[model samples]
Target: MKKPTMTQTLLFILVIGIGLFYALKYGNKAKKDIAEFESKKETNTTTKEIIELKYFGEIDLNKTEEYIDVLTNINGNEISIDLNIIEETISKKTIQPTINFLENLHEIEKIAHKQVLSDFKNGNIVKDYIEHHIGEFNDDDLKSLGIKTTDSPKERKQKFLNKIYLKRIGFYPEEWDSLAIFDFTISRDLTQYLIVLSFDSNGKFVDIYTES
Candidate 1:
């Protein structure tokens, strides 16, 4: 064979150099892609494990759709917690804490009830209710309750407040229906109201409001 020229040798070296550069570049890119894929897989696996372990008996994935229905007994009353999970992915950070909360709902219910009562007495819930529905009470109803229609609004309001006593109708959990985790139905004898309490993922009270 004829000896290769210097020009041919230089061209061969150039081609080899270019090929090696691309090979190294593509090889690094592939390795980076694989690493990222593996990291995502590990993260997903960890999340799945947490959900499975933390919510083992609290929820059944097959039976759950938009929310998890947890039946609980409180003071001999069969109450259910409809924990919301609509448009949510089952994960520890999102759903597990709420499940944990519902697990000890019997105790939490007491705390929530106490807080609601305290708020009702100190807050504007009663005032607002009296303001909104006082007109609904006719002369006969007022007389029966010893409230005079001719009395000043303040006097009437005080009399109404005296007659008002909260009787808890039932505990309704409809986290799926609204932001509130627990909806405590309170009957003021003349009217019914809902004490809607919302909690964070960690079972801390976030908000409380009254609705009729």
Candidate 2:
């Protein structure tokens, strides 16, 4: 085979050098774009949007998984809280309600229990009550409380729910025959609270009694 001329060799070298330069340039640009995207994502996670109570919508009361998750993560630390453990903790705090709001205590006890079971199955009871009772606070209210978020309204509301969850005081249980009534109170004070949640047997939320 004949050796290549100096001109041919020089041309080959020049082509290879140009290719390498373009490759390096492209690689650096791609890495910079990725880095910028990641930085924005981290900033978003660190500075979340403020959530308010008015945005409360349908909740999956049957799905305790998310509830346990928020309860554990309220500290801003990612922790896994087992459902069984949470239930046990709630049970320990369970007590009889100071006032039984049920009108027909004996009659409604069974009815309420049955209703709760049905609602849990239908995934509507807790959702309905929450829709009816959650606060009217808006974005302004959340800002006043020092809660900040860039998330959508629904996500904001969920964050607010989780935050308030950590302030839960205890569970109060009231009995009427076999029917069970439990009041889960959350507040800075044990006696008075921001909200009182009433649930029946089978861990179904029945009503919410709030203090104005």
Give me the candidate number with maximum lDDT: 1
- Predicted structure 2: lDDT: 0.40
Tens digits of per-residue lDDT for model 1, 1-212: 99999999999999999999999999999999999999998875532232342222544432345644555557665555544545434444444455566566567667766676566578876567666666876687678788886899889877766654323322122342233366654233555665566665455666777776
Best by TM-score: 1
> Which runs in model 2 stand beyond 4 Å of their true positions?
1-135, 144-149, 164-175, 178-181, 185-212
Expressed as tens digits, the lDDT of each residue in 1-212 for candidate 2 is 99999999999999999999999999999999999999998865543222121112222222222232122232243222221113222221222221232222334334433443454346554334333333544556555544464766565544444444323222222232223332222223422433434445334445644452
User: What's the lDDT for all of these models?
Assistant: 0.59, 0.40
Candidate 1: residue pairs that collide = none
Q: How do all models score by TM-score? A: 0.47, 0.25
Name model 1 segments beyond 4 Å from true. 1-64, 68-72, 78-80, 130-180, 187-193
Candidate 2 displacement at residue 46 in angstroms: 65
Model 2 deviation from native, Cα RMSD in Å: 21.3
> How much lDDT does candidate 1 score?
0.59
